[model samples]
Target: MTDDTAVQARRREIASEHLLFKLIEYVEQRHPGLLDFLEGSLDHLGDPAHDETKDDEAVRQIARQMITGARAEIAE
Candidate 1:
């Protein structure tokens, strides 16, 4: 991709991540179901929780999978 496309993509990613964090904060603040939802989804997908890893790799992987699945579903 060109420089412009790369920049735009990065911006999009940043915006998405920001929105996701905000949503998590909102859910956690309001219903406190956010943690349960995340853990449940990850568990259903056969992934481990935060204590399973000291690094963020597992969290990143789960986030990517969730985003990809959501995108595909939205596209349909």
Candidate 2:
């Protein structure tokens, strides 16, 4: 990759790390048990018998809501 492309990728990586830290802080403060629940849900989703389209959609919606809530919290 060109130097500019490499710089842009690095910037994205840093931004992602920042967001991840913020999300962790938010979860720890506002929803302490949520991380465990998400971990369990993700493990369940990996099962072949649990691969339902409706379930995937529901998870996506829940994730979107979590992200929205986190963003709002960060803004405050």
Best by TM-score: 1
Query: Over 4 Å off in model 2, which ranges?
Result: 41-76
Stretches of candidate 1 exceeding 4 Å from the true structure: 43-76
- Residues forming the 10-long window of minimal summed lDDT in candidate 1: 43-52
lDDT of 1 by residue, 1-76 (tens): 5799889999999899768766666656667555556755653453345464554556657676765544444345
TM-score of 2: 0.42
Question: How do the residues 1-76 of candidate 2 rate in per-residue lDDT, one tens digit apiece?
Answer: 5699889999998898668758766776776665556545653453234445446556556555665565556557
| TM-score of every prediction relative to native | 0.51, 0.42
Error (Å) of candidate 1 at residue 45 is: 5.7
